[model samples]
Target: MKRLLLFILLSVFCLSLPLSAKAEGLRFGVPPWPGVTVKSEVVCQILEAMGYKTSQLEIGPPIIYKGLTTDDVDAFLAGWIPQQNEMFLPLKEKKAIDVVAINVDEAGTSLCVPTYVWEAGVRSIADLAAHAEKFDSTIYSIEIGSGMQVSTEDMIANNVAGLGGWNQISSTTPVMLSAVQERIRGKKWVVFHGWQPHWMNFQLDMKYLEGVPGTEKLVSNSVVYTVVSNDFAKRYPQPYAFLKKFYVSGAVQSEWINDFGFKKIAPEKVASDWIVANLDTVGEWLEGVTAADGSAGIDAVRSRFAN
Candidate 1:
């Protein structure tokens, strides 16, 4: 009787050990922007190589913040600060979500006009008010719940730059680009929101409008961050360290987005190819890091991607 009891207890302990040691999977929140989607996919791939199972959930900017607060999301790699100031500030004060690190830097987000429109004298955000009729009294923007949309709403609410009655026509990035293309095709005057690290900059001959005297600098900004749960650093030191060291520039993201933007390739494939081609850079990301299962980081990644 005693021997049988000991054997059963040992078997249960062994089985429980494996269950308790299993790494928690990740549920990542991704916004609907080409640059962000591509970047998030790359990060997910890297994390997967490290042995963490990642799920990408496409939620709006607002929902991402809420998700973080509710513990419904594990991370978001597309947190654009200052632009996303309203969403993060209050939650941050409550100790809900934490800013991990800036993943992509030297980014630009603001209103712009075709170079031809600038030639016709709409070279500034303030210039739009006077040419409201030409622009249809509308400022084109991305999805309704985006940070850029919030910024646009603030501008209208505050009547910034004499844009009191201006209507914001909300659309997706592709639709906004189509609007720009239409204006360009007809040589019409149009003012709309624009940003850098986008294929649009390459596709369209457009220029950013100068914000009002003190605001121009703010609109032409950079650096979108990787934000994780506040406890993520303490609970997952290796992943945190790897994310902190993970850095990519606007040029890198723009090129990748452009590659898929013009031609149709999987975002994951682009990221994998980038990883394989830039093994030296990725090696640095994996330095001092280990797989989710505690295996060697670089070796695990190489083998996983190799297959």
Candidate 2:
């Protein structure tokens, strides 16, 4: 009878422990871009409210994907398709990672010039070379080793848009934008890498150039995806399921990015404010999902962020 009583006590003690005690905390990779930063925070905040411990690592794209493959990072929310296709395809082929969901769509990157430049007879990629003197034969881009930078290089090497001797300036996003702002103020001609779901679209008076003939591939629209290491779903099914339901439209994502990128709000504050304002939408992401302790996920989030 003593043995039976001790077994019962042990079982009760085991059941009393929180589920998170037995589960590994999630590690999310956040790229430098504002949109992805905001998205990562939104996911992390919701998971935290669901009783899961989480951490955000500020890693760039190449490292993020490699980390996902090696299980160093559990997930990344900024896998921009087509633009990132070259980076994601091999790992996907090896079954090293899984794209959980398309978080944002109708997104894209391309060479863009200020509206004044556009209005001044520079409406297409083909027009850039004609005004090369005004643009100083330069195209500004963010970071070395980015897909956009590579594409810009290809354009220069291949002499696309007659840019045979052109130069692509490499810099961070903030520096590139600051240059754009300066150019806009001076009403000077400037061409730079541009994409949606970014504050630049709203803040700058610019237009994406029409693709040059035979170079259409460089200006294609892209879809941003949430990606996870292959083992993530099996290891953390609740958070995985919640992540799969996550979806943010291009327009809405741009708004979140603008709040963080332009308004200079903290990413967590931007996420929380969006969550508080869009409870109905947040509920959709939590549908059929549960907290780490098997409680209703939506209820936990609502209670935690009720203010």
lDDT of each: 0.76, 0.82
Q: Tens-digit lDDT track for model 2 on 38-139? A: 988988999999999998876567777887887678998988877766788888888889989988887988899988888888888999998989998989
Candidate 1 accuracy as TM-score: 0.87
Measure candidate 1: CA RMSD: 13.9
Clashes of each: 0, 0
Worst 10 residues of 2 by lDDT: 14-23
Report the Cα RMSD per candidate: 13.9, 14.1
Best by TM-score: 2
After the best TM-score superposition of candidate 2, give how far the Cα of residue 172 lies from its true spot, in angstroms. 2.4
Angstrom error of the Cα, residue 107, model 2: value is 1.1
lDDT of 1 by residue, 123-195 (tens): 7787888888888787777766566777887788778888878887766665566766877899987777788
